[model samples]
Target: MEVETENKYLEPLFQDGSLYQNELKCDISEKISDILTTITVFGSVSIETSQPAIIYKSKKKIQAQILSAIPHHPKSIDTISISLRSKLPFPAISQSSFRGFTVSPSGFIVLSDTSQRLGIMNSCGTYDFIKKGLNSYNDITFVDDITVAASTINAIEIINLDSKLTERVISFHGICYGIRYYNGKLLCSVISKGIQMIQLSNGQITDLVKQREPENWSYLAIHDDKVYQTTSNYFVRCYTMKGEMLWEHILQQSKGVARGITVDNNGIVYIAKYNGNSIALLSPDGQRCRHLQISDTKKPWGLHFNAITNSMTVGCVNGTIELYDISYSH
Candidate 1:
């Protein structure tokens, strides 16, 4: 389901001494608010407030509260597809190198090419490249608006976007292939160790799942509380946080190797079919599958979907990057 909020202004309803003046105002901007939300399976809700809640920015710490709440239903999706916007002029890397990219909530794109360069592009199409003291970056993800975490050969480096410098590094025992940030922690895919969860506050690592044998080039994406992972045997699997297999689907041999995976707001899964030269979108139930037609000739390697803005960014193995506007009918 989709909900759109229009741009408007909120003003004070009365003088400072009014009875409702002391009421808590919620200004938090994250998708997950501080107020606890409880919803049943495949459900949506809308909360209406008596007064407009103003959202403002301030350097000083601000306090707010929510004294009251409200609830909804789900819809059926008929079709899902995308349209090309424009090709992003990212510098080309080797065709055989690892390519990974991610989209921020505010519409910026962060990409990792080979082990030599990292590029950050704004909504205006201009970009900056960072290369000094760079390591072999296999994958990249946003920690927040101003920070990002990059997976290296055997470590994860926390880099500040403003300063473009490495702030901290968390070492690991095995090869780190894919990395993602959720809540306040980082979920990473390690070669033979499977998926590992790392707490950003404290350097604590927990094994969420373990692989039976060593593998190469593992990638994953998270939605709601479920984790989606791609396998080397031409399959995509869904698992719980505790490592329980929920469902698994194998793509046709014509799609080539499944490299990267991401899920949209509606729980629809997307995978980058490397040599097949296309991006595949699967239904939430893992029963229906469809391939997105790409006008480009380069093979698609990395995939990222921004649920808030309904946009997608695709990175190819030959260092080509493209953006698309996504739409779905229910």
Candidate 2:
């Protein structure tokens, strides 16, 4: 776990000048017994209105959740969302220049910023403070119910949500971009060096997943026992959860950079990127299946997917939260 060299993350991958042929056994089975769902974010405008739209998918049914943040009447310091057309309203926190939002494995939402204070909110609108130490809020990822982390200039802050404790903070050679939590494991994006595995349970750090051939990832997502990421040049690369390269897919000549990613129960990956006025759906292995574009092209910054309703939660830089439909009938 102690990454000793600049190329440390790759050490365990090659033990003795030979490929670590330690064929990592895995449950890469695609037999998902759960319901099928998908979600994509996009911007769209009607002849009468120009607003961001949210896309969703679940059980072959699609629904939309509007992301427009309207005033909650009392004018409190807490940020909350009220659907102008929604019957069920909830309180949530919002911050400025913020691009990170994460849903804990326990269903709590953490919206954070290094420029501002970090906020934790639940579906009911209750907000709490986790910690404060980042110079700039790059991204937020949940490690578990008790632990959530954020990336700043040169380090990652691990916070304990239950006790409001910052357990540990660590830095590396490059800036951190995005992170994801799965089964208590973490995958962190190191701007120029690529992804690093920060083992939460064991307290270890593996730096250069694969030496010399890293995609220099910027965003991270884990599913189907593989790690999916958006690397430099808008390419999508898939690797084993522990940093093994299973496959790589690229969108050559695509309009913009791949920014964020989400996956559905059916094993499809959804992407939000720079040149996107819509959401791009890719195969589990990184192939572009199709793109669902919004009528408007407002820049989407943060996105979360709820597979149960196929609802895609989107946060745009233009100050809006919208939902979209991404379900396809089989």
Candidate that would win on lDDT: 1
Model 2 regions more than 4 Å off:
1-96, 105-107, 114-116, 124-131, 211-217, 252-254
lDDT of 1 by residue, 236-265 (tens): 888887788888888987877788889888
Candidate 1's C-alpha runs over 4 A off are 1-78, 92-94
C-alpha lDDT of all candidate models, in order: 0.75, 0.60
Residue 268 CA displacement from its true place in model 2, Å = 0.7
Cα deviation of 64, candidate 1, in Å: 21
TM-score of 1: 0.74
Tens-digit lDDT track of model 2 for 1-330: 354462465444433433322333334324343324422323233333222232222321222233334433322111212122111112232433546777754456777653445667665555676656637667788776667787777777887777777788876666777788767656777765677777777757787374333333267777677777776646777777656787777764465556677776666776775556666667655544566555453666566666666566655555444555444532
